[model samples]
Target: MNTMTKRLTAVALATTLAVSLAGCSHWSKRDRNTAIGAGVGAVGGHVLTNGSGVGTLGGAAVGGIIGHQVSK
Candidate 1:
């Protein structure tokens, strides 16, 4: 594959990973933390990756964490 195709593939793979993890379960602090970390990581990752669409999953992850921030 060419350089462009490889970059596209990397972006696509990252996008898929980001989206697929959305709406993940949060039954424990560990699970919650993992989700938050991944979500924030995705956003940072997306920014680092210079992707807009790919950041939706990251946003959701952060949103979920924010939503659950009050939970025990």
Candidate 2:
């Protein structure tokens, strides 16, 4: 995909994740943190890797793990 498309996709994904998480009133703080971390990581990965899919997924995974552990 072109650079613009990739950037837009990343932004959309992040926004969707954030908005969806915001509506989950029953989630604990850790749950929220994980979602937030995944979103941020995805964006960061996309930027760092120039929109590589593998990079994005890896970032999300690492971020989720960190977020999950942060509350401990």
lDDT of 2 by residue, 1-72 (tens): 688887798889878987898798798999988888888888888877888899999999988888888988
Score candidate 1 by TM-score against the native. 0.37
**lDDT against true structure, model 2:** 0.86
Predicted candidate 1 versus true structure: per-residue lDDT over 7-63, tens digit per residue: 675567667656765655534765655565655555555555455556746665665
- Residue pairs with colliding backbones in model 1 are none
Model 2 / residue 3 / CA error / Å: 5.0
Single out the weakest 10-residue window by summed lDDT for candidate 2: 1-10
Which ten contiguous residues of candidate 1 have the minimum total lDDT? 41-50
Candidate 2 TM-score versus the reference: 0.81
The TM-scores of all predictions, comma-separated, are 0.37, 0.81
